[model samples]
Target: MTLDEQLKQLAIEAQCHLAKTPERQRSLSRLISIICQSNKLVRPFQGQFQGVYEEIYAEAQQRLFLYLCKEIDRYNPELEVMQWANFLMKKRFFIEASRDLLPTIPKGVDRSRIKRSPLEVLEKQTPIASQVNASLTEEIIQCIQEDHDRLFQTTHIEHKPAANFQYIALQFLAGYSWKEISEELDVKVVTLSSFYGRCLTKFAPKFKAYLSQ
Candidate 1:
């Protein structure tokens, strides 16, 4: 199958898989194995694999899964479930896995010998704290509003559950590394990295997209 066809199938499979299963052990296993195999291929072909694949993979596996799980557990979840599932599928299959096929270079040019300019290299690097802080602030504010709405509609609620992303984002923005966030959040470093990565992907794009509108 073509890559696009494969991705379409993958997204459908992912949705069906999530709908049938509440426990994610099987999903995690399949996704992690796919990721490890892709990482093996990608690391050796670093120049060819565009930089965003790793980030995209983390979102598919972690944040999207968490969001879906939350929806499944909710009492009345039709809207949230559909929205999150569609968003997750689009992000994984279309935005993440889908790519234009590059034509092979003609016999004369040495494609492997090409190098990035300084500006290109700089552009490839992530600007960590400032960007993370801005995104976290926005999500935190939204989460707080969500809490307010829930509390206003309900009675005798003690406190709203804090968003995992809000806590982690603020920790990283306050000069803590993934290790520190993991320690505070009581998760493994790998899990923390995965969560932070997924949140950042959704946060950055949504924030930028909103600004452009």
Candidate 2:
């Protein structure tokens, strides 16, 4: 049988075995192994990361296993299970690759070139908070919001950030951890962190001016 036909057969068998209490674990394990071993699933990332392909492939398999376990009940026999599995595996691969490939800021960069965290900047202004009028505080916040919107526009023109960059930044401003943002946004934590770094690089000067004012 062809790969698709083989996958359909496996899906049928897997569902049947899942329905049986005694065979469920064994069948699931076997099915996961079969899926992980497919050339089509593993070929995309093979030999791509130099010495880390094995590591990435292992992580991808682990992620795929978890996904399959969570989504087993929702599996539809009418659809191609292998295709779904391929997509999940590929996504996991890219996430792992992104984590491994995220660039680091160079040491000895000027402090002024680094953007201050919004929360940190806000905290530094606390001593002056009592002296400032309410309208002034509101205006400052409005100015910061405008700066964020402007960065969002400029970055789109320049770097074309992932679609969720704005939401990620808003969540960061609201004091969410990268882990929390990852879970809430269905994005990898590393990807969000990297994107945030890029945003800081581009927005540092404007943010620094805002903080100074």
Clashes of each: 0, 0
Clashing pairs in 1: none
lDDT of 1 by residue, 1-213 (tens): 643333333334444544433222233333333333343212212234354444334333443333333333332323432334445554432232222112343233345433345763463243333231213343444553354445312321124234265555545555454444545556655555655555555455444444344
Best by TM-score: 2
Span of ten consecutive residues with least summed lDDT in model 1? 93-102
- Misplaced by over 4 Å in model 1 are 1-163
Query: lDDT for model 2, on a 0 to 1 scale?
Result: 0.49
RMSD (Å) of each candidate, 1 decimal: 15.6, 21.7
Model 2: residue 165 alpha-carbon error in angstroms: 42
TM-score of 2: 0.39
- Model 2: clashing residue pairs? none
List per-prediction Cα lDDT, in the order shown: 0.39, 0.49
